[model samples]
Target: ARVMVAMEAELQQHPAQGVLVVGDVNSTLAAAVSAKKLHLPLIHVEAGLRSGDRNMPEEINRLATDAITDLFFVTEPSGQEALLREGHPASRIHFVGNVMIDNLFHQIGRLRADPAAGGRGAALRAGLGDRPYGVVTLHRPSNVDHPEQLAGLVGTLRTLASDLPLVFPVHPRTRSNLSRFGIDLGPNIHTTTPLSYMEFLCLWKDAEIILTDSGGLQEESSAVGVRCVTLRDSTERPVTITDGTNILAGTNPARILDVARTALAQPASGKRPLLWDGRAAERILDVIVDSPLFQPV
Candidate 1:
């Protein structure tokens, strides 16, 4: 109710002809619902992604958002196909590549240009220091929302930590759950507060491998040619698994351990997905500019 009320007030003051919501989240869903209630055209960026798991709330958000979206700016071929399969008009769906990659490319350039900007490089080097190590990040509700699952995941990581040093920037929710569940975050795994993007990227770029439940990490790892193990049964961004260096491990500790070991032992290789070039933001703007909704009135 609070989200709806705030959206209503914002739109009333601004009087937009339509709303364009990006990615799947509570905000995205709220905007989608508000736009439809206002009888305004809705545009959805990164539309038609599905993890095929009905239990995940993000999957439901994607479904609801895509249903009401007047225009679909997809990020990949599979997204276009997903929209087509669901009976959406192909004319309304435009494959505009990945806008997130544009920001990633920019930040990487900034990090490379000013190595001293964040002190990220030195911090990373000081922690791992010429030794190969793995990075771990887990924040998905499915992974950490429950007591048993969170404890199991943490315990598994603790075991893996003995094999190779694992760095984890703990999410607040995970930390609370660790305390609530009486799970000891063992010393073998290094834990820190959540890091800024540059600092996190610094750690990620130098890691031997990454084990995560994050959608963005999958794409980033694939983009930068790093080995990644996804801790989910399915991924909405299938391109990461199909073309990139991502391997799905679900929540099974044994499976995760097996994949991590194999990943560390093997020589690394990965292929970039189509149209992930740094100009994706430009393409998105081009579509929005040419759209009938935004034309001179």
Candidate 2:
């Protein structure tokens, strides 16, 4: 693959002591494979996550990348347990918490400091000032690629919109589906093109609730203490549900509506998962320095 070749060339020319890859994307797997083939130590961040759905491409990437990873940096206890069960050495697996949450906190601090930052966020706020709103995002192939399933979700969103204003940052795939399937989001649902990270963070941070099929949003919402309803049936990040304010409603229309309604009615309340205190990157650095892979020969 292109990523593998590029990684190989980069390593051959610059010869790093260790190669680090993050998350379960295709590039992560490619880089992991390249590192192993070149006899370099492969460090994987956000490793050992499993959604148990082999059908998901990301699940496959996680499994394959962890199989050859030398050091595993995990976000949650479940990740550590999953790696242990898969026969990875305990010493190599470090529970360094979620770096994404750290970035979330950083961005939020920036927004708070300025209050006038993020153009789109300010515009959105001006439009919906002093009113409670909800956020919706759907992009998973399991939900959007299939017409029948997508229609069901749209219908349910329409119903929810009648009661609550829903701001949907529609993914390109979802937008195409809307046009192709002739699905109307109804007047109550406001659709916008995808937003910048700060714009999105500003929009969702104070929302009453978020409806999403995204893996990262689930964790971000939980970190911000905002109620979130996951549109997917299974999530790799179970800590969000157990310790944070995330509810799994799957794709079923009735369940999603019921859960979203209940979540909206309740005040957001949840403890941050252990070590999600914006120090995960620091912990990762400490581990790397202490690790044998980085020790002087």
Tens digits of per-residue lDDT for model 1 on 1-297? Answer: 678789988998899978989999889999899989988899998899988998988899999999889999988888999999999998889998888888778888987898765465448657677788889998888899898888888878888889889888889988888888898878878888898888888778768899999988998888878999999999999998888889988898888888888888897677888888878879878888888877877
Alpha-carbon TM-score of each model against the true structure = 0.94, 0.98
TM-score of candidate 2 relative to the true fold: 0.98
Best by lDDT: 2
Q: How close is candidate 1 to the true structure, as a TM-score?
A: 0.94
Write down the RMSD of all candidates, one decimal each: 1.7, 0.9
lDDT of each: 0.86, 0.92
Q: Model 1, 30: alpha-carbon shift in Å?
A: 0.8
Compute the lDDT of residue 235 as modeled in candidate 2.
92
Model 1 worst lDDT run, 10 consecutive residues:
116-125
Clashing pairs in 2: none
